[model samples]
Structure formats: C-alpha cells, structure tokens
Target: MSHSIEITPIDDQCPLLHQTKKDNIEEAGKINGQYTNKSANHIIDEKLKDLDKYTSKKFIAIFKVNVGLRKSNPDAYTPMLISIGPYHKKNPQLGSMEKYKLMYLRRFLQRKRGLDVEHCITEIEKLKGIALKCYDDIENLDNDIVDKFSEILLLDGCFVVEFIRECSGMKPNREDKIISTNCMINLVLRDLLLLENQLPFFVLTKLQYMTKEVDEVPITKLVKETFFSILPKMAHASYLEREGDVKCIKHLLQLVHMSSHPSYYNSLWHVQDLSLKIISKDQDYQTWHANMPNVTELCEAGVRFSKVGNTYSDLEDRTTLFDIKFENGRMRMPCFEVDDVTETLLRNLIAYEQQTCDVLPKHFSDFAVFMDYLID
Candidate 1:
C-alpha cells in the first residue's frame, strides 16, 4: 500500500488534527476591505496563489507524517485503503449524463449489492428528526411572519417535487433517463433537515460548486455570484402532475418567469481555472463519455445502478423504483414502470402545451403565422 506523512504519531490526534490542518485550505476566500472592480480580480488571483501554496505545504507535511507512520505500523493504513475515492464530491459540474449514470450505478451496486429495491429505497425514508424550532414553527401559527415562512416552504418544496418528477423517468439509450445527479442532489437536499439545519442560500451555493477545484478554489464563494434565484421555482413545474397543485405551481412559475437575476457572469473566473479543471478531470470524464456504444450510450447507463438495484429491466417500460407520492397521493411502486406514467403525464402536459400554443399567437403575429404553417 502507498504511504503518507500524516500517519506518524504526530503532535495532534488524527481526526481533530485533520480538521485543524484543513484550516489551511488551498482555496482562498474573497479578500475583505473594499477595492475597485479591476483590483478585485487581481486581488482574488493573488489570494488564490497563496492558498495553493498553503495547501501544497500541508500535503507535503501530511505525506511525510503518514510515510513515517506506515514504516512504524503498516496495518493502520489498511482501513484507509477501504476509504478510497471521494466521499462527498470530487468535481464541480456533473459531467456527461452517460458517464455519471454508469459511475452512480457502479457505486450503488457496490454499496448495496443484492439488495432489492424495497430494502434499498428504505434509507431514503425514515425519520431523521426535524429541527425542533423549524418543526414547531410549522405546527402553530405565527401570523405576522407566516407569509415569509410560507414563501420559503413553497420555494423549497416546489424545487424538490419538480426535480423528482422531471428526473423520475430516466433510462439509458432512450435519451430519456433519470438524471442520477438530480436524484442524489435532491436526496441531499431532503437530508438537510435530517443532517444539517435548513440550508442557507450561500451554503446551497457552495454545495453546487463545492467540487475540489484545480487551485484549491472553494466554489462556495463563486457560487455566491453564480446562482440563479429562480432556480427554486423549477420545482413547481415538477409536481404539476400531483393533484390540486396546478395553480400553486403556476404562481411559482410566474414569479420565477417575471424575476430578474443578478449579473453573475462577471464574477466568474473561468479564464484559467476552468481550463485547469478541463485538463485534469475532463480527461477521465471524456474517456468515459466517449466509451458509450452508439446503440446503448444514451440510456440511464442501462440502469445497472450498482447501489440501487436498477437494471435495464428495472427501468424497463420507463419505470423507476422511487417511493414517490404518486399523482393520486398513493405511494408509487417500489419499481414502477416509467412509460405508463409518462404517457399519462405527457398527455396532460401536451394538452397544456396546445393551450399555450393557442394563446401565444394572439400576442405574436409571427407565431400565429408559424402555427398556421405547421397546421398546413
């Protein structure tokens, strides 16, 4: 097994030491104190350089300590070998869907081999006790702040339901598979109440961009400028299939549609950093994405999801094995078929699409002419 410096009987305890050592991150924070816009970029750049130096130094120190420890006791390193690969997140953007789906499948199977969907899906459920304050606030009334809290609920809930619905029907080869990233992401969002406090906007921003960056850049800062507030509204569209929620969904969408977003593109620093990522991680990603066979490449990595017991058969007829509240409020099957649900949902969506088509032409003569041409 490979050895490192951090394992040596150090002056610090391992876990606490690990956390303490992490204070010297390779990624830099935004420099405090005001500066002109031009100077801000340069300042950010210099800080990033310093952060990288600190991170490298820490890595060297840790390596030296670990190598010394392995020489002392090789048995200790074995546990670490089992912990290989990233536990949280490794990269920023979720790469090509095909590769991610395959990777997800592999991980799932490895983690939960031979587990049926019923047993596998159980971890996603069960009580993880709520924030008592957040829970209590929801139980009894606060008339004055009810509107604000309600607004948050509407935003958060809508984002989740729609994301699930939109992603509920993914499969490989069909070009209509569930996005594994979306599923994992949504679960993480739900588990926030279970795991952490209600995720603040900045934390949410960090989670999106928190993949280890090339120069040890913490994405949370960039995420501050990168996020679209209206992103929360996409959830409303998803739960449209659920009953009695149509008007609420429409109102949420209307707010999103009317909103203006902050100019985040300027804060982005892709000029060099993005390239560093592309050169590094993209090679592995490109290799995986390119490996797809033309025939089966586009499907949900053939559903052979390692962890979730998903197979092409599992995804057959477009079904996924989510413990979802079906449109009728009953629990959908542990492994429900997708095509049946989509045909029904798509029919309603298409009908709505037609109504939209009918109405949009009144405001746009070009649209009216285009509709006429299509009918002709």
Candidate 2:
C-alpha cells in the first residue's frame, strides 16, 4: 500500500490555476492604477485651488538671512540687543530692549504736548495691514490681535525716530540709557541695520511727519547723519550729499542702500553702462570661478595698487566698485574699508535690495558676487 501511492503536480493536473492566479494579479494591478490616478487627480485639484486663491502683493521685503550667508557669520545677521519688527519680536535675548522702547515712546509722545499715546496707536492701526504685508513670515504677526500689533508698530517706530533724533545731537531727556551708554548705542545701531530687524519705511515716515518740529531737520538727513556717523568721515559723505528725496525708501536698509549709491538711485545710466561693458567684453558675469587673480597674486605680477577717491564715486569714467583699471600693469581701484560692522551692513543691504527693489540693477548682490570672485 505504501509503494502504490503517487501524486500528480497541481500545475500539470489543472493548468487553469496558473491562469486564474495571473488574472487575479492583473485585476489587482488595475485597481491600484485607478486608485493612483484618482490620488494624482485629487492632488492636482488641490494645487489648482491654491493657485486660484493666490493674490499677488508686495508684502515682503525683509527676509531672514539665507542659511549660507548666516552660516558664514551668524552674528552678522542676528539682532543682539534689540528687535525692530515682527520677525524678532519674540526673541528672548532681545526682550531687555522692550523697556528701552517704552522709554523712547514716552519721550516721543512728550515731544508734542497733549499728544495721546492712543492717537499714535490709532495712526499705526490705520496702516497695520499694509505694514504687516511688508514682511516675509507673518504668522507671528497674525497670531496677535490688532491692539497688540498696533502697540508694537507705534512703539518700535517712535523708538527709531527718537533714537535717530537723539543721535543727531538732539539731546536726550535725562541721560537716557540708550543714548548715554556708548556700547549700548553701538549695539542698537548694528541691530537696526540687520535685515530682520526693520520696520516699513512708510511707518517711519508717518512717525516723522507726526513728530516733526517747526524747524527740525528732515528725517532723512537726521538718519543719514546719525547712522553714517559711526563710519569714516568720507564713507558716505558724497552719496549722502547727492541724495535728493528719500520718500521712496522702503526701510532702514534701503536707506543705507540709497546712501551707498546715490547715482544708481537717481539714474540708470550706470547700470546701462555696466551691462553694455560686460556684454561687449564677454566677461564671465554668470560664474564666480574665473581666471581672476587675488590681491596678493596681482601684486606679485608687477601690478601696482593706487587708491581711488571713493568706493561709490559717480564719475562718468568710473561708475561702480568693480570699475577697476589695469593700465600699464598698474591697478587703480576705489579704496574699500572693511570693519567689524561691514559684513552685517553689507549683508543687510544685499538682502533688502534682492527682496524689495523693483529695479534691474541689483548693485549690492552684484558687488557681493564680484567680491566673492576676488576672494575665491
């Protein structure tokens, strides 16, 4: 009985079993395909809905420093002692300056007798939405109610106006800590120049008009004198002198930008000239890596260095910082001064120009790229 047992293979006995298995697999694949198609369609519909709801507006100008730039020098992009806008409003390290802001606000209000704090808050409230739109991330701003946002705008705006006024030789009231402390004032100045720590230009302008004295100096003049005083005497003298109207400025950083290149702000001749020169010469403007020699190498190659008048000179012959000439193996360039605040200052200006300016000549970004070529 044990030797008589024989078993046939299932495939040989019933070939239909293999066909049925194949059919089941194909059916499962078809169902999965339908499900995948439905999912893709749903995703496309959602994206279309988002596109339809999107509205174009110029609400963001100030941006967080790019990670690459920030990684190079974190302190250059950070606000150490003070916060100006919604971006850094909640930074605990900057919390100490809140009291100083209030102190400045009090002095600001006292400038005009019988000017209620509520009045300033109300004025800021009127432009609150527009002001908020001028920032990149507004979740922190929107999370707060109107009252809180208005107070912040009013306080920060007035503090900046008063600080600039005080720095411009308008004696502060009763030895103000911010004005009296040299180290603190320097920190505040650096903080103000930060890209993230900024308010809308219109907000500052509105505050200026409200608190302007009968014979007070213009706000632009005061700001230029106050902020640029820290640099060398000739740092921004020519540019500041040439600037006419600053009402079109967008922020503190933009003000610095215009102060740096007055000719660019007033006219596009320099930009056109640069574009033509680069295009005609077939220079590698697109890539940072080129056959550019560094300062040391150029010196060893029998190139003599002579200092030009200004980094931002508007002479018809020389228009930009990159207007270097190597005539007869001698190089003539505008003297560029580098200092502790230079990186922070330049980084903020570049960020502002890249984000806010509508014009084609991104002079700051272009200059940065040019510098990178030399350094690399």
Best by TM-score: 2
Off by over 4 Å in 2: 1-57, 140-142, 145-147, 172-178, 231-237, 242-245, 262-289, 309-324, 357-360
| Clash total of candidate 2 | 2
Q: Which 10 residues in a row give candidate 1 its minimum summed lDDT?
A: 80-89
The residue-by-residue lDDT of candidate 1 on 1-376, one tens digit each, is: 9977756565553343245445433231223233555667887999887664232221110011134333544332221101111111122332232243344433333333374334322422221111112222222335343334432332333233223223333122343433446445433322221111122232122222222224433222222112221122112222221233222222111212222111122332221232223233444533432232221321233312122223233112222222112122121222323431222222222222233323221212222222233233
Give the poorly placed runs of model 1, Cα more than 4 Å off.
1-127, 131-133, 136-170, 175-261, 264-376
Cα-based lDDT for every prediction: 0.27, 0.69
**Candidate 2 lDDT tens digits, 1-376:** 3567588885576443345675365445455463345566777999888764333355566677778667777878889898887777778988888888988888888788889888887788899877766776564455663347778888899899989888887754566545678888888898888888888888988998897888888777787877764542234444457456665677887776666653334553333343324333555444323445666766776668787666432333223444444466675556655667767877777766666648456766766765564466
Name the lDDT value of residue 25 in candidate 2: 51
TM-scores, one per candidate: 0.16, 0.75
